[model samples]
Target: MPCDQDKLAIDDSRWQVAVAREAVIRPLINAGQLSPIDVATACRILGLRRSRLYALIEQYRSAPVTSSLAAARPGPKKGARRLAVEVEAAIEEAIRDKYLTRQKASVSTLHDHIRHLCRERGLDIPSWKAVRARVEQIDRFKLVRQREGNKAARDRLRPVPEEYRADHALQIVQIDHTRVDLFVVDTIYRLPIQRPWLTLAIDVASRIVVGFYLSLEAPSSASVALAIHHAVMPKAEWLLARGIELDWPVSGLPDIIHVDNAREFRARALARGAAEYGISLLHRPVATPHYGGHIERLIGTMMGAVHMLPGTTFSSISERGDYDPERHAVMTIEELERWLTLEIVGRYHNEVHSSLQMPPNAAWREALDRRRAPFRHPHDDQQFFYDFLPFEERSIRRDGVHIFGLRYWDDVLSPWAGRLDRQLRVKYDPRDLSCVFVEGPDGAHWPIRYADLRRPRITLGEHRLAQAALRQRGVRLTDEQLIFDTVEAQRELLETSASITKSARRQVARRARSLNAADQGAAAEVVAPGTKDEPETLPVLAVEEWS
Candidate 1:
């Protein structure tokens, strides 16, 4: 019945009583009164009683009706008006000067410029949002004309062209400089700090870091050359002491040295070095990195290890002073060096490669075993870098050495390059054979006379000599053989180790579980069920109320 109220009201809307009640209510309200007759008529029209109508009106009146006929009022504080005078001035200046006209400048760029201007004037700049608001107030419909062209085309792909090898081992050693973030000790300051430098190296068959140079700056041709020397050199002194005497250069003279387009790699010194070693040098494309993928991967591996070192920061060694044992880990430089050579390198060589399926050392040894007898690592290419690469020592002149037209006079380099040709060693990277590095007596090496630095190119013929010396005692391999063997070895090692370790873990877990179950069962038998360990009971208190 209650739900039928709307239906009853609708039905009453068609009755004559409803029309009469609607017409009579206006006059009664004009008289500022509601008569019984009017109330009765309204009740009948609306399908309710007179008392109910009066009660409903009172109830609704007390139910809080909001005033709908009120005048509009302003909202809460609309916030302080921003100062756009400076922004307007800047925009006008930009427009007048043609620095920017029809094209709209980004809010961020505007903010940055405004901030820079404020900094120059020693004035505080407003927040970025305020700056943006000002810009919007001035010209919200501004359009920025963007230059259209292939950005990818601007950066040509320069990949190190891969050289074809016929066999495994040292067939084609790829060399590249990877900028690694690392902490180096500033010997002068005796503090630990972070520094980035060029890590140059050759990736032998097993992707081992056969040779590398860690410097505080981008590597020079000489640094690259030194890395090559290390690559060809015998195992580190510590490794040799530990009795790891196996013929190296096992694969052979790298028939081709692959490198990126860095000036060091293209230097004459490096080219001469490679030529002397009977190794052809190849340069990568302008921007493509995948051409020399192995060396790139090796760089990643090296940096990964570097990241694991503690207290590493992003700074230069010269700025922070020599690595402080107190600040860094408690390892001395010699100790750290030893660890790197013996532990890191040793582990790396011995670890089974995911791609090669064999340890680098194993692959190297196998290549050696397959080589021409006497099992001696070849010396044929050892002198290639060592002899042909030029080392010059130059002091920092009042005017720095003009390398490719740029003046590089770092305070650190100033101490070394101040003098004229003060006997610095300059070695070139073989890949490009156009750039040479100035090597200092303090073992600091960097690219010398880079094209950007405006250094004149020395003639290659001056350094060119016959590849007279063949490696009398090392294994030689074709490029193809090297890659196949190395890859096969890595794959084999990864799959084999995974399988063996997984099975061994499963067996050990199963055995341990069985032993645990048996022990539990035996222990259970010795324990008696339903032992008489009675629960403690509390005494009940008798309550008495005495009058």
Candidate 2:
């Protein structure tokens, strides 16, 4: 009808000022002290519309008006959009849909789910604060607890544990595995076999590597078994065996062994065996890496050391160039292991740690001053060894303990042998099949040798490979042919592995590296800048502030 009200009225501030000005002028106009033209002149001076002033003059005659006027920080009625009752509902739905499932439903992830729902429904989106507020309405502790269980809930929802008292070394140890970025050679041929995988354990408080194991073989439960054994058992004998003359001093059952959820780390043997010695196993929340940063850094540092070696595959392809990691590779697997050992005790442990400002060994020594608790050790080393080995339960037979079609016998088993009721647990190392240990009723480990004493020693892995190869070739392996096939299979494997190119070997190493339990990629933040088509720097802050 009339000029649109919004256009006819001045902005809210001027409108208020105009009303106030009219309020004071109206008395003069009513008193005949001033006329409409005089008020119009004042309205123009105040940048208030003359028409709005006239309109307000009429309202003032009828009702009261005030000077207080400014646009309320604009948004929705009653303030910023109350997270559309639907948006709040969406947030709860997203939390249930994402957090309640297996995927790590981090706060950001929950927010993303809500945003996606808002987009799909064509609803007005809210600020991140609004989304976060909705999320806060849910019981965070209960959410984490329900999804990940007790330990995880505490870690996620609560502050870092002050009770840990890191003044003592080995209070908590974090363990993980990495693939060395170097090609390793065979003992005889001196050809690159593969980039070896390394299992490492660090004393969390000390930032020192307490134990490590390196092998050409990929990580397995066996690898974890070896790493734990190395971590707990004294290193003096091992060092002496390797001819490494240095003090390792960092071995004992740790108070807590923090690890990630890998098959190796989650192995039943590891859990039970550790508990038997008062050590508890802890797995970090999935997709959280900073929890195990110390060991992850150690793995990175160790790999950096390997990268300096002659046959290094390097971290990425761009780092490799035309240089051949294989042809230039000179260290045998044993030699590499020795180098790693020497580097650990001789260099890393003794060198000053960047964070601690003291050598790890020195830190270990100082922590000992505050260590009031007696050092815990496994009561039986042999039993400890048996505990970690994979096992099968079977009653002793007329011959002996038969596993995977191989009969293993020992004089100790003779007492229980031929007794169908006597169910003995047989534990064997996957790396060595020469013998198996039969657990007695009293938990004694009886060494059961292969019945054919003339047969040479072979590992379970080799045996499996041989059996598989034999089957593939339409051949059957009798007990007499078992050793021969095993040896042949092993030789074939080594030769075949040795012939792989550096790039292929690097790929294998990379795959293993990606499998690291530390979630190596979790901490990285990815940002993509605009290209030539877009401005390099958008002066968002300055422009917004100026406006």
Candidate 3:
């Protein structure tokens, strides 16, 4: 049988194409310009059978070219389309409305619905196979997305080829925060703390990890600023401090930092500080995972490395079942910090990146060598530190400057004390509640310590937590009350163990950090030991802020 002789459905436009080919070849056969074998070859090209070729040739001699090329009318042409137009309309409507809405409905269900709908309309019905064929024509992507949701849509959208091309390093950088999937102990207490949070910055072009801040404290503006500060400055001092000899050449003020819409990223302090340095922040769209994928992948890599160490809270319950992370934990936060630094600078940087098919260090060096633009940093480290501190406007009262619930005073503030007309601008580090800086109308900043200097320093977070804890105990602490009680609260948490009570993980981490401080030296302020959560923000002010 020839291809044209075995006719397809009239609705299949290919049938008309076959008919047109026969029309074109019939004239050649009739004009005697072609021999029987030649005609047979032409019919073969036209997909006409030998018998069909002779029939079409005879029909073509008596009919117009247009008539010969037309496909025969399909269905019982004498009746109403083999089924009423209303019945076909009902089947189509059932497919779009009934079949598409169901997530797991089969074609048989669609066929039954079509017949049911046709019966209600008092119209003729088509075969179940005909209705099932209509199901095949449904657009799966659109149907699945409507029934299943964006996640289904997103899965199909992935494996998208890379259209992004890069010319320079830091053309765009992505940043994200993740709580490490591992439990680490305190250097002093040896008690496992909550998994530390890591704020990582990644350079897109070189696939270089610019810098990261790890803290026992939750994700906050201070940690982000600390990370960005390290990102923008020279790595020599940092690398030297870590006693690391490896070259970490990737450091510069990125023009833009892409991050999620976290409260930390939207912090006014970060915004103001970034604006000063001409760095803009772009917030990734909510629920859009791909936007921050670079840093996310880097985090996964870091976490994967950490999982090999003892105390890892391996990602899933199945992986972690019967495994005790706290009991198995060995490294302290600071040790992990150092270990992660070595991994990033030594292993991660030296290893080949998937995107560039070259080591990150090499890519960074290549970009730098190609363009020797001067590396930009703040003129002064202290100033860069100050620029990132959270600030607010407050009027100086006779009692001196009070923020939240604590009073800050310096004899230097004696002059500004009792002055109500002046709304002085004040900058504060939340990590320490012991002191604050007040911007005098004379363009000078006065450093004011807590009115009671004898008291041990505590962080604003610790202070707030203490006050809340005290309130729960029906005790209200006033400025006149012994401020040292708050410091005791800090110690109570730091000195306590979670081995028995299994206290809240965050509190356990807070306590461990405080103990580490005491071990290092019970200074007015204790600096957390740095970890892969790098850029350990030391206590410039008394008190401790846990990661």
Candidate 4:
């Protein structure tokens, strides 16, 4: 049929595209090469683009073989010619064995390595665009694995053999806290409330949660410390029942405690407790949830299992109670602890994990058996505590010290009034970022107020500058006078503008240095640094603002 005849017969304009499409597929059909499905797919892909081709094909279909459709203008050479075999080999080799290695290969790194190899072999290469095109042609880059089974398979596979022991199972345990919302009854308000707080510790090798606790409160330092105690210390009742003597200097104190910087986990008391237990605390970077993947994954599992419980909620009146939120509960703390110990933990240890192939309990027992000698628990009454909190050496300014260009202050810092210019270590909570604990050489810590820079307010330095401007105007300012009143008045008039002449001078100096370093070409392309968001303010007493 004629292409235009078929196009006219279809009332729906979209079907007209099929005429043009069929024209493109007609040549392959005449050659008796393509399958019926393949021709349809070709027509579907070509759609409107093949309209002219379809017309030409229909014209030639009824004519002699000499009336075959003319070939179009040639585009650039594609496919095999773009990607060379040599580049493909390197990328494949890098992925085969060293994929998870420390020096794993990346796309840019692969390109660089390929270029180096070409240079060594005395081959001239094309531009980076050409190299990328060539790499894509042969599927050299390992794109994201789209299969769900792949990640689960990777997780199930162990990096090393089970028998291989770095030491005891407890030598390097991982600890983390997660909030699990539970359906519980509120005794005070007589309503259902979301109760959250679940802290857990696992032996690194076996992946067994040796200690676990849950509550309707926010997790805190004491919660983590208690969890550790439950994992290491034999229960008093268990000791009494078995008639076994409890040993001291707990056997196999974890060498490292890996945890994310949750407020509860990053507390000074938690760090001190870990240090006392002879464990090195390792905290993950702020906001990076993937670092604590194991605990996070477990949280998902617990929520799936527990939150489905029927008819129990949190007590509403309990918020005003004297009890710490970190504590599990006053009335049911022991019962909850016992239930966790018996039900979730006990069942979890006995179940065979896909990763372990054997039960977690079996794997742990085997790991313990592989230990060269028996562990003797520590009996010493005294313990050493190391301050595991992160500290940065910073110079104090005003009543506040500038950390990362933001002001932080404490009312207790009045004693250090003279040492404002001196550098001191500022210890802070990596989690919340709300309170900074100021520490001295004696290792004493005092909690200080911390405000985010995003807050709308005048900084200490700006307030001082306003006070100075007002004092110069012969205004007798009282101690309680607002500093912003004087300073903000002439803020616009005091602003300094940048000059092109100064900028040119700096550019010239930079270029000269670049020339000295034999990087003249790079220096020419360099741009000057941008101005700060807020202008630099003169030094002032931070406490003065509060006064």
Candidate 5:
């Protein structure tokens, strides 16, 4: 098969004929039973024998794409080296040292260089056509990057098509984050807090929402990780936990995750985790918004649904005139999440997608029917969740491994204590400081708890707030006890004032959600590794009113 089955050269007449053949046979295959007359008609149309026609039908059934029927090319097979080893090496050297440089040398110059080198080695000179073919074989992005520069390559070599294509389910999934267009209230106060951010993943082939993460906090690496974790793992248990009965069967490690060039999307944690799970990450060009058109459309569709809810902001001031979202806000963040889940699995999946021309669920099923093998899923659920989390390297001492002013100790750390040769990698969920995972030498992550077992589990946000409070009181230096005490005091204050103060209520609500996340073993509370306490400002989106 070709490396890129979806793309075919414009002048590839054989592939074009195969594509036409596929179109003629597709309906007959769909009908399942082929009569003698149908078979004879298909054989006549395709200029093939009965046996060859049956074989083509089987091939098409296994992979219902035009490329599946592509005939083997004449001459040297793909990736075959026809020239002598020394001559090929000379040609490669010439291309690398001369052609692929900022000097912008032409193919003729490269061919001449290759000829001269072949003569120097007393080898036969290859044709200019072979040299040009080798040059064309070099990746376009790499070629442009070497010859022009990174910026030019990025700007000039993006896909020109308006719609991103995927041949099967889980082939290419797009993940993106957007602030929901509704104001959700605090669970206790029943008063509006703020719009929550939603990190969503959509399968490009079927337009099915594979997974998503909703939070009151802004989008971060943690959001991306959580979203991906949800995307890759089965949703049966998750749906049952949420009391949702709808079947959301879409779950698998996507072949490629397409994303925009946001910092969270580009985080080292995400890149490393993707590599660990055998998933490819494709970042769209810097200024190419259309490259992300599929996800953007999905987001828009979701927001359009949101506009029907009680506390909807209506997407623009003009549309929201004379209406206050806060006064009408009814659902809490958790409630909003549940509502979105119902909206997705119950309605969106069943409803017809404009692009797919069929319901997403149906498209998913059809794609699955075409596949010879099942989609890939993570084997270890817990480890998959931990892999995408931001990590820190900490040295283990006699007492424990110290991080964020807290010490974590477990029997597992005993073996690696006091080792100056290397620091162990510790992965923690920012939502819970009760435990951290210390990676052992054998690549297994050991869960290490706080040295003081009695210390209550607190979120990174709460910890940061307490630290700020301590600094305000002129406590320049502090200990674990001091930090926990400050956190407890702050929580007490927030609880006490929650009924009267909106800000206090918001904080209390956020804390409750954080504790819930920690209980579910969900790591990340919008804090990326190596980032400070303050959150980055979200980019302002232009108004995209519903048509």
Candidate 6:
């Protein structure tokens, strides 16, 4: 007879029996060498015939859950009801409005409510057993969420397995941030600064690295945006710009981006951008580290490879007893980035993954072959990149929009000027504050530059530093000119002291990164279509040989 697994309910005795059978059968199945003696012992322990025990083992092998092993009783279907349609409707309404509430009403209270409704409507009351069966049909997760709270439901009902699984590439991608275990020097001064943070995304199915972004700044919404942008866009031009000959073909929008409950991951910009591109953001339950095991393990593997470099901290202080990472740090941040790219594309992708039992590149290609369809790419690369930028809402005055004490104005702002009914959204890139993209009323982003075109471009970090310096001098009310002047003065100070002070050197490195981004943008404009250029090679850094 066909059984409805969804409606089936096993009593405590059957559930306990299933659990006992699972304890004996699971290990034998995992061993893969079941002997007659083993089967006989299991049958004796479970008090079942040989044929029955074999059937149960096959059932358990198909689905290792305890519920799969529960015996189905041959009787009226557990939730099959012969009641009138109106009576069923009343019971459902009562359960929803009265039983599933914060008041934590009991079954008897719910029965009374249903009795009153039935009496009012001139319908027969449902039996207590029928009402209880219907209540049991309610999803446990939803029931817990309604009676208890979200946190309690999440903690109690989350999947118990440690590994998160995906069937194909780009189905589930996990993103995370970690501080690199090696120190990198400033580009100009060649002095050690703090370790850069790396934001990485990995495809869970193939265990391939989709994209990564490294920055001297701590993890933030901007870093997450940039990392995701890199993951979605094609990497041919990016790789060419870095002079890498290796192929990194992993690029596309993931169906679900699994992340932890960090503030940056919960940012409005990320959530909205993901929704715009038809991507779902899945946040693991709070404090569940194993839920993100794939990304965490990838980070560990990358860090292990980093320890082979010249200035590695070796994961812990005890491991670095007599070594000095800062003094030995010879590679600049740019060099470190290039080295990491090489490691990811040239080495990591080609090596056999322990979990997949094949090279990640091989797994990716095989998955694509089976699907027989090309991966989805962004329709407009530039528009896709701009969509993830951090934004703010501001009203446009006759002069223009004001952001971070700087006035941005363009001819496009003339139509929406001095409008009090609504404020336009302005999106800015953290790497360059020279211009901001304003979303007009017509649902288009218009680029607006500084009102004073002669003013130089400054990074968001530099702008903040300038504001801090002005505050130190007790300048409460400052204009754009004052802010720019302070920024220029700070740049001069950093240049002069960069070689001696670590903080100054770090600031210089950050500024270099900002300028590098701008330079890349300019270079992309001059390059002809379908043409490649030889990028200038950076100086090679020393590395100790791995045994």
Whole-model lDDT per candidate? 0.45, 0.66, 0.67, 0.46, 0.79, 0.80
Q: 346, model 1: CA deviation in Å?
A: 1.8
Error of 3 at 6 (Å): 84
Tell me the deviation in Å of residue 169 in model 2.
1.5
Candidate 2 lDDT by residue in tens digits, 486-541: 56655555556644554434333332333331121111111111212222223323
Candidate 4 off by > 4 Å? 1-168, 186-193, 236-252, 286-288, 311-336, 373-378, 381-547
For candidate 4, give the lDDT of residue 505: 29
lDDT for model 5:
0.79
Supply the TM-score for candidate 5.
Answer: 0.68
| Backbone collisions counted per model | 85, 0, 12, 15, 0, 0
Q: Which ten residues in a row have the lowest lDDT in candidate 1?
A: 1-10
Minimal lDDT window, size 10, model 5: 1-10
The alpha-carbon root-mean-square deviation between model 4 and the true structure, to one decimal in Å, is 29.5
Model 4 over residues 178-256: C-alpha lDDT tens digits? Answer: 6544433223222233444678777766666666645444565645654565555545443343343432112345556
TM-scores for all candidates: the values are 0.38, 0.61, 0.61, 0.34, 0.68, 0.68
Number of clashes found in candidate 6: 0
Residue-wise C-alpha lDDT for candidate 1, range 221-240, written one tens digit per residue: 75666566666655445256
* Candidate 5 per-residue C-alpha lDDT over 1-547 given as tens digits, one digit per residue, 9 for 90 to 100: 1112322222246656766676677668756679999999989988999999999888766655455576757664444357888888999999999999999999999999988888888999999999988898787889999999998887798655556788888889999999999998888779887888999999988889999999877788877888898888888988998899889998878878999988888776677567444566889877888888889999999999999999999889999999998889999999899999999999999999888899999999987776544565665566577768877877789888999998888666676788645566788777677778876644556677777666787888889999999999999989999999999999999889888887888788877887786666444323223344332123445667998
Query: Residue by residue across 458-523, what tens digits does model 3's lDDT show?
Result: 666667777776777777755534335765755566556444343444565665464443233212
In model 1, the Cα lDDT at residue 178 comes to 56
What order do you get sorting by lDDT, best first? 6, 5, 3, 2, 4, 1
TM-score of 2: 0.61
lDDT of 2 at 31: 56
